[model samples]
Target: MQVIKKLKDFRTLELLQKANELTLKNHSNEITLERAIFLSWWCEKGDCAFCYMSTQKPRISDPKKARRQINSILAEAELCRRMGWNIEFLSGGYGSFSTSEIKSISQDIFKITKQPVWLNIGITNDLEEYGEEISGITGAIEIANPELHDKICPSKSLEDITNMLEVAGDLGFKKAITIILGLGETPDDLEYLFNLINDLKIHRVTFYSLNPHKDTIFETQPQPASLYYAGVVAATRIMFPELEIVCGTWIDNLANIGPLIMSGANGLTKFPLFKMFGTRYGKRVEEEVYWSGRKLKGTFTDFNSLKNGADLGELNPFIKRYIDKCLNKKPLKE
Candidate 1:
């Protein structure tokens, strides 16, 4: 096992290359792409320093609007199913609703979609209350270090996050966690974070690069280097060989995708399938405005094409060497 003591060590391409080899050895060639829907941007606690939604207006008592939003989400889920993506994920801004509300929404969405669903509806103290209603739970512990987590996300405690994960695991739900890179956390901090995940037996992890929103507190902070982000992905693969490493393609640009996949990510998440299909959800102003200042646009193949054995049109050449080497298969020329 590779032991990295410094953050800079993760920036080394050679280390990333070695980690990529290890990832191929453990997991096969196929990359998994999962679909997700943003249920709501309303957070009740509203104290996370790094999130743009943290300072948004509180959730108003408007049942009509809420119902419309639910209908729109279901419509989007139906489109995703037609597109050949069956695993649907439902997520929202943290503390947006009560645990009971989340359960109700999950049950409704599951019933309407009739598909496997993963819930990322923020921290719920009683996750086991849902029982088999949810296929999995994503407990996002953005930063692992207690001090950093406290400083960055004051709304929730690390203890609470761990408790949620433990409860989800005990309930036999497929457990996953999301970790944001470049949140002022160190290599030791990451080591500590993964240790906790291993202890909790959480096997699936998603990594997001910190893309600061304009009005958020973290906006003034320097953006994380792309290479540094890729390094962290590679390092995570090296540290947890058996764990599934997922890259958040929504947060990073197209150029970084190759390096991220080559480094060790076996799955992609948070893709904008609805946006690609030209579905307008009416909340676009609020949603697009937050990610506006940053250059979030990029060119990538749709999930359906990749699922049907079609090569990534423009991206295949750049990543083919790594994919070929990892899969031990012949290379294809563009």
Candidate 2:
């Protein structure tokens, strides 16, 4: 019902009202969503030209460093948990670690908290094998376009991602799928993706706007208008009412948020000023917070800032405003 093709004659007030109502329904409390970082040292073999880490490098410098990394991420997770966030997400470059590497990740975090942990590593060769040890792990498949999937990530094909979902879904693991809009994909791609997610019973869906990272082949490509993303989010939510949809990493600003929320994004990720509040180029919350303190505020360290930022209500608005802003988008004129 929130889906609209154009915003020319959009009615803003009504859109805001509906979006707020939906936000309250989905997220009853004012809490920040927990986020974790998984370091990806390299692109998988045959990585597309657009990937930031596509250069030749090992997935990780050493598995030994994983312990320190997990410790850092978990420390942040614990803080987020204490702050009332109900979710903990582990994000990083895919192809950076082996499946066995994730075993250690799961074990380390399990020692820290009982909160839900979502892994955002790209496609893998064998996720089903980890089912026995990774009962608590939530899986993510991050292929955006099937054609570009092969073009960009040849080592892992679209079929591979589909297979991962089928296997994970059948295994009864809570799953999440990511769709990065604007890779020269079409409406048909969206249809296929939505249908697959629906059938798989994926726990969540994340949509990322294609951002031109520095030095990548897509560096000069313009991000699609906010209206386009809002339409997709709205339609996706309508198609899967119960699925928790998220607007991730590349969302442009407070203004862009309104359209997406109205269109049906029930959940969102937040971070402070990436190239100013409303623009797309930015770092994740964990990275931003860590660097900000390490450089500017001598009194605070990563762990301390993690603990403190977790409790700060001001940090929650980036997410809240996104949905509120989406809700404020003028409704599509009938």
Candidate 3:
């Protein structure tokens, strides 16, 4: 309604700004981080036709090395816990790991800090495998774009994923479904998927933009326009007002984020790509946005840390320059 009428009246930027303001009013001013820790066999078998690791570049990381990485990420999680971040997430590639291996890793992470562990790995074959022991475990059925997903992740098709989602839902876990935009999906297809997830009572939704991955089949494919992406975000917001919407920065970057932020996006799939070390910005923006909003700070400072709210206004000066050069925008003067 509001979005549809406004769509015809205002330019893309104006619509986006209004959406951003509306979202900001409803969310907190603090940013949280979500981190990905790829376990062994991370990208070994099921490489997306668009991911760098999927190409002929190199084999997956060694199991021992992957463990070390997880330990390092856990240490960062400790830092986030001490700072009182909004939330922390740990997810990775496939369900290729043994049940014991997955459980042990989940337990170790649970021991370190009490941050919510949103599993973005492959769907497990058995729910009994992840029982009451793994209490903080949240289930995510990522990549629901059937045909495109088959092209990228052939092993896990739409039917296989749907079955897993049912299992996860029945196990009394918080279930999330992810849909990657820009795979040539029709508006009707997108709407159907969103409504289907909602009907199933799955309350969390994540949207990602499709970009070229080194060595993937669609490496030369162009990304969708940012304004178009914003409209999709807005539509999703209106349809599922209570759904936890997470937008990934790895794909959206800075240029398109303003619009998505306004489109009632409450969760951000944060990573080093956005300069946030390991936090996921969920339904919140950084207070430092008041400033120049340029450099990507790994962590967030307390809202009360600044003297006046105005003191937080100056953002990192280079943010706009980065967006212009990167993302789907025309380059500006250097």
Best by lDDT: 1
Candidate 1, after superposition: displacement of residue 46 in Å? 1.2
**Residue-wise lDDT of candidate 3 within 1-334, one digit each (tens)?**
4455554454556655655555555555433344455454344455555555555325534534444344444444444444344343455555346678667777665665554355666656765677543433334333444565566566656676667767777777677776666666655455456656776777667777876675666667787677667776776666565566767655335555655666656655544432332223321334323231222223343322211212111221233222222233222222
Clashes of each: 0, 11, 22
Badly placed stretches (over 4 Å) of model 1 are 58-68, 86-88, 94-101, 108-115, 277-334
Task: State residue 187's C-alpha deviation in candidate 3, in Å.
Answer: 2.3
lDDT of 1 by residue, 1-334 (tens): 3545534555458767777788878987655555667767666666777887665655455423433255455544544444445453677775555678767777765765575578887777677578556888888788867888888888777788778878887788878888887778876676787687788888788888777776777888776777877877877777788888877754336456667777787766665543433222212321332232212121122323223333434433533432232234222222
Better of 1 and 2 by TM-score: 1
TM-scores for all candidates? 0.75, 0.67, 0.70
Alpha-carbon shift of residue 120 in model 2 (angstroms): 2.7
Worst 10 residues of 3 by lDDT: 304-313
Residue 264, candidate 1: C-alpha displacement in angstroms: 1.2
Regarding TM-score, does 1 or 3 come out ahead?
1
- Which residue pairs does candidate 1 place in steric collision? none
